[model samples]
Target chain A: MPKLDNYRVPLKGPVHLADYDPAATPFAHGTVKAQEKDLKMLNKQLAQLMRPLQGENKRSVLLVLQGMDTSGKDGTVRGVFKTTGPQGLRMATFKSPSKEELSHDYLWRCHAVAPAKGEIGIWNRSHYEDVLVPLVNRWITPQIAKQRYAQINDFERLLAENGTTVLKCMLHISKDEQRVRLQERIDVPEKRWKFSLDDLTVRKQWEAYQQAYEDLLEATSTTHAPWYVVPADNKLHRNLMVNTLLNHCLLDMQPQYPVDYPELVGLQVE
Target chain B: MPKLDNYRVPLKGPVHLADYDPAATPFAHGTVKAQEKDLKMLNKQLAQLMRPLQGENKRSVLLVLQGMDTSGKDGTVRGVFKTTGPQGLRMATFKSPSKEELSHDYLWRCHAVAPAKGEIGIWNRSHYEDVLVPLVNRWITPQIAKQRYAQINDFERLLAENGTTVLKCMLHISKDEQRVRLQERIDVPEKRWKFSLDDLTVRKQWEAYQQAYEDLLEATSTTHAPWYVVPADNKLHRNLMVNTLLNHCLLDMQPQYPVDYPELVGLQVE
Candidate 1:
């Protein structure tokens, strides 16, 4: 078993997807039932940890999730935060940029929903998608992609300095795993609603997407906000690892609960 | 029984809040249980009506909700949309604008989330707030408010012409009812999370908000997208009225599935 930091993209070198195994479950050390129990405990701890963040009302946290389709971004949200509840957290899903959003810089819409003081703002898919999708499809040049990486780092550093802890995660899943999930979505009556003809189109560009992800993970991994590649071929293990990483970040934040209001320390209310 | 159009703000002349009784249950007849039964039926019908809109994939619907503090915008959404489910509906709640959002023209953020083709988009306190809040708080001049009215009309008309059905409802609740709801938030321990001290400051400006609403309603109620004032003091009646209005809009849309595609008429999947 490796430490959590082992998954963090190295800050000083090139990134290679081959270095990380998508089927590995290095974070979980037990059977499926034992891992589920560990996840239940982690969710409870996270819910409690979020309270002081809300009470202090001065700092915030943002968890960014980026992955290919069927990589379980939505599932991770539901599974990890079932106990943290909605009030303490916000889930912002950045789909294709809208006409008005396109009228501004790429980060305009993302900044508009930055977690206010005292909330855990989670992005199911985030600003990273802007870079990945365009870069993979040849809609943007390598020079432009490089420029975006610098811009993203600066934007994130600004948030970090001004009361936010930005954590980014790339749900790393195997191509074979995605095929099974896509097939289930097509074959199962309940899940068939999600079967889109477009999914197949994107799947054809799998290797290009993997290259794009490797590029972004290398370029944007900064000290202020680093990226983590979570091996997410196993759904349960993905939830456990992501939740554990999130809980670790929250503990590190250690938001304060103000205990200094002395004006009416002993005054009685009528 | 008053017809649906009876509650629509007339397309001409000055408006008066005095004309409507906020506590009246004119839209709901019979027992509480009976109204509950009717709502359940309407929810199912609303669900069925929304599917065709999705299948046609040619048009969309936008439902805008605006009201003063504690006037039940959230409640109406939960009640009316309980059965429409989440698949076809996109609820965009517009809170106080951020610095980035404020930099854009008022309608920029609203337009960014305008429902895609074949979806029912709901705005819980929408761009209408831009007009109402600023006008009441004296953040904008009368001339500017009048200018905004024209701008909003033009914006909405564009959406209508571009295949979006715009339905606006102002959750009309009496000041006394607002006080009751606010008090419950303060008095109940569970709801204390919702008791914002700022709400008291806003409550002090009740009459000003009503005037703002009346002004905007009169100025922007065009034939393309009219404003409906729902008597929202009674929780049940508010749900019934909103559900009925929404159901009516979907029925009027008359979206259909083209079940005769010659390209696939005889195609078979092995």
Candidate 2:
């Protein structure tokens, strides 16, 4: 319902800490707790719609979730989809391609896990990594990596053409906020296992990754597959935004119930 | 642990409902209260595992859930994995295949959504439907279809060998108990959605399906792929049994803090 295109993050290339504004925007008011409650109700209704789709045996959905570290993607999945009937959902999280996967094309591993008709397939972090991580870490040369970006666009486009409703989300969190979370993990005894120094190394390159993300969103947020930039500084807001976006998608799709079972005629006990 | 082999449903095919004494194992002692408490704890821990795995640029998991219509499969996933970190855990329920999938091998649709590494993949009903459903209904001739029983065994064997950790559970509820639940669904206002008049038609063939399940389990449960018959008559016991089984699996897998992080150096941050 909101302007999906207007939510892009600005880029001055790479900004120093002095250029960072900790208070800027600070996640929009009323998007957090207020939307969360609404999202839960919407999800219950949405579940009913998604349920019979599986039974129809004809169509399915592909939900792609992308976000920064500690952006609460997991929480969103738990809170929003916690009530959906499991019969119609399939989730896949792509990491670095395995030794076997790397032996093939980047999209090969992704192809192996696409959802079937009458199902919902989810990607936690998908082939976008083929662009985002390599660009941020200089793992690939720019010229070839740019080509990879185009390949990704075409790949997602093909999936969409074939009936996969692509819902891509970018969970946007500020650098300082991520630092706050990383430190909290270090400080809390129960959460200590979650901490590692490598987290800080990623934090150091935060601005560059943000720019890369901004660029990725601009290039790939096409009519068929648009990116929804969820203001994720507040975990609650991130979940609400995600729920709102997905609720919108399901409404738009308006998936219907399967035909009643002819096999059940006069079968009920009076 | 409990003798793994002895814990299973007996091999000669399921004994008649009247034969087994419910009072002999009414519920594992304290398993009920422990379930209420353990579910909260399990949900929290699973949430933690899901957070980073969702963001990690590597492996995903596919979880398959299957049970009788009201065998508490949906409720178990909702309660136990309620707080499951959303990023990596995806639920997919299988029904009849599409024209495209029915045109191919039965495994075609299932392979399309198998979980990638490091993610928890859930299946509500998997390819095992070929063995269970078809075998019960005489939908396919027993000669060709009974062969599929062995094929499914090998297919699951391949999955577990490939790190999928295939866990198959049969929610064993008694016939009288199921009738009571079916009646409750019809009589209760809130539970009306859960009842399908069609289910009574299926219930008429329950004894046949039970025999099919028993025969299938006997022929299929291998060392790599074992089946857990969680006494599901009691909902709390079912949840606790599932949690214990899964917790044991994760702890055994020993997913760890990466050893290479330079942060492990002597800062004494804690």
Candidate 3:
């Protein structure tokens, strides 16, 4: 297995999307079947870790997933968290901002849904969208985009300073891989609901979007909440890598069941 | 397996808690191991049903759970929903009302969190707590309790008429069962956080709470939203019964993927 740190974007350097191979499966060390079995085991371990995390009730984890359409953000969530109890996991999906949301600062909506202590919050598309979408469409000036990057870093630092451990992943997929996935969505009848004409409009700006991601990822990768770019063309590899990243974060936190109630040690219910 | 309707509280009749046996495993048709296997199958089917439900995005389901302490509400959620994707399931846990909550009508907090279209909402404890706790403690007179029951029925009707299928389950466990479960929480260090001295105070009013439950169940069991008394003393049996009930409900709803999109046929992403 490759070192996870290799995937982490360095805090002080430029990040080139070309350096990461979307088709690489560095974390999958064995045959396809074996890699699947490992994903199942990792999922169970994650479920076990969730109990103590909720019991401790003093810290939280936030997983920010940013990816192009058909890059498997939804699939990653379903695959990785299939074994977890719904009570311990909170999921928020951000699409085009509503009028009310646009009325406020972009960060305002994200902050309102930030994970509370003792919960693991999943943001399917997050505040980073504020930077990505506007920049790709030339809606925001480059200077304004740079300012937003610093603002986002400060926002994440505030969460980390308080008990949140933020783990962000950019699901990196090749343009050809995206073409295949988008075709599947269009061709499959049951998946037709997920297909929107707007996806094509966004796909046309693929190169511009890639450039925006590269710039924002370099600017926002911080000591407190660094970004890890996951090679996501292989769907199973994407799930496995994200699950492993989350499991590692939880283990490091070392959440334990609270043990401070001396008064109830021998108390009997009526 | 026993007929599920046998457990349904009738809309036109009085509900007698003594008539139900908490320890009976009517739904557990075979050996313990076999029943456990069936639960796994049911969980998988529920997970399958969730996708189409979300794809249709027109209807929803709300599951309301109410019971005395140690009746296993939390355990039921963890067991039944273990296989579900977190995105499709929205869980709301209502504890004691805050000062702001107290200032509003009892149902305000519940209304704010009702499941949106295409989601399954689980209430760990619910607005029924308003009827249960207050009436048991004599904080509300019988007349007001009757009024609240009517109000609750009307509130649930609005949800059903608007496409939310409501399923309420009362986890009925005997006093002896509660004694054992509460003791386990005290004896088990990891579970100690769940114990409270106030649990004992409430247990002392067990008969009063039971009476309150019977009265409310009879009054609130409407055609649109009915209540099922789940036998919950045997933890495995409780899980099996609830899972089966939910599976039956979802199957009856017959949620399907939308077939209305004609604009994208043979359309290719550029």
Candidate 4:
């Protein structure tokens, strides 16, 4: 069951994080104990599609991830939201900004934590780190990183015309698997508070952040937010390819459960 | 291992929510499959003490919970944080208070999501429902519910003198177990969007919300935030007594990890 349209990323491209093969496992099929028992049966079918996507509070999903430093993105969000528990999950990490989140407009702190309306939202490192750290520290300008990739594809096409689904990934790893995960986070003294000397000056700009992630994965692969590219050097095939691309985007958003409640169908709670 | 100081709530006197026995499973010792294998080994040792309490960013833990209306507080936060996944967990959920959270105060949207530092916050129906739905609908007075239980014990002793470690819980179910969980959420059509005919007008003011939870568990049981009545009608002994009182307050806050990086000790990541 591999065709995640062969790791997407092709909206008419010139994108080459050197033709992707971060130790490829094309959506792993069998053994690593059967892709961790199919990532615990797609993390209990993403905790049963996050309870009718938070009891059908209309719609929202987000995801986003992106990667590189230890290319696991907090181990694919703790192995694909280990049973979607932090109730309707909202996790937003985006570090390196605060001064009142650089006084706005950097998608204003990723649109002030986006996923609402029955939430799932998980960014971790996003708003594509404002065009990959100001276009790999030339502090912006490749025409302001192509106008922040058409203003992040017009702010993810206004969150997919207001019902939000989004889902992006990148995780791709290698450059000798990030020098063996930044030298096992400096010989693992409980992973030395996730090592930094600016992660060895961003691992000496590993080929300029892989050419600023192949020019923002070829200017933000769009059709209302599409990205993929996740081979992530097998941390269980990057948490079984981002939990099978977020259980194929919540089984194509079949989130229901909001039963109209015909006058509480023979009501009685006395 | 029952003595969580015999279900805590004692910082001085009279808190009889009928002396707590909502189907008591004194922290359920054996078999319900060995207390669901000791709640999956205390949810993997509380996800390994949430990575050194988020790499010792310097203490924090909140919790809160409170109860009634099918007293399971989202199934004890989906069974004791089903393996702490939403990175360093923050939760929140308060519910009724808008018009800009009833124009401030009522612990101003719970001191704007309190747990910062090395996070673990979770409220789920808190600021003790601003003193239980305005002192059980008399809508304030009882001297502003005794000045909001001494301003929620000086706002949880200013989040326990700023390093935060609160811990509240109250879950204690049984008005015939909330009439068999509100009649299995009205005979379950995918639990009919969690049925609410204002949950039967708060189940006909259940003894004035159990005498406003026996006067806020006898005036906010303190010693800088303590309160635990938790019998909770055996939903696996209310998730093994709030995951064994949050793994005994993260093993008495033994959160360490920030190893003062000695100039990257023989450092080399190139």
Ranking by lDDT: 3, 4, 1, 2
Tens digits of per-residue lDDT for model 3 on A1-270? 678899999998789999999999998868999999999999999999988898999999999999888899999999999888687788898988999999999999999889988999999999999989998898999999999998999999999999999999999999999999989888888898888888999999999999999998899888899899999999999999999999999999999999888898677766
Q: Check candidate 1 and list the clashing pairs.
A: none
lDDT of candidate 3 over B1-270, digit per residue (tens): 588899999988779999999999888868888988998999999999999999999999999999999999999999999888698888898999999999999999999889999999999999999989998888999999999988998999999999999999999999999999999998898898788889999999999999999998899988899899999999899999999998999999999888877787778776
DockQ, structure candidate 2:
0.20
* lDDT-better candidate, 1 vs 2: 1
Each model's lDDT? 0.83, 0.66, 0.92, 0.86
Question: Which prediction has the highest lDDT against the true structure?
Answer: 3
What is the per-candidate TM-score for chain B?
0.98, 0.83, 0.98, 0.36
| lDDT by residue for model 1 (B201-247), tens | 78888888888889999998898889999999998999999999999
TM-score each candidate: 0.66, 0.69, 0.98, 0.37
* Superposed model 2: Cα runs more than 4 Å off: A1-49, A52-59, A85-87, A136-149, A185-204, A259-265, A268-270, B1-18, B21-25, B28-76, B85-168, B174-208, B215-262, B266-270
lDDT, residue A119, model 1: 78
DockQ-based ranking, best first?
A: 3, 4, 2, 1
Q: Higher-lDDT candidate among 2 and 3?
A: 3
In candidate 2, position A112 carries an lDDT of 79
Which candidate leads the pack in DockQ? 3
What are the DockQ scores of the candidates, in order?
Answer: 0.07, 0.20, 0.75, 0.29
Off by over 4 Å in 3: none
lDDT of 1 by residue, A104-123 (tens): 99999999888888878889
lDDT per residue as tens, model 2, B1-270:
343344444544543434433223333445556646766776667666654453442444444555666777777776667555344564666767778888999987787767766667777778877677777877777776668867877887777778677667776777777877777766654455456777887888887887776666777666666776766777776766676666666655656533344454444421
TM-score of chain A for each candidate?
0.97, 0.84, 0.98, 0.36
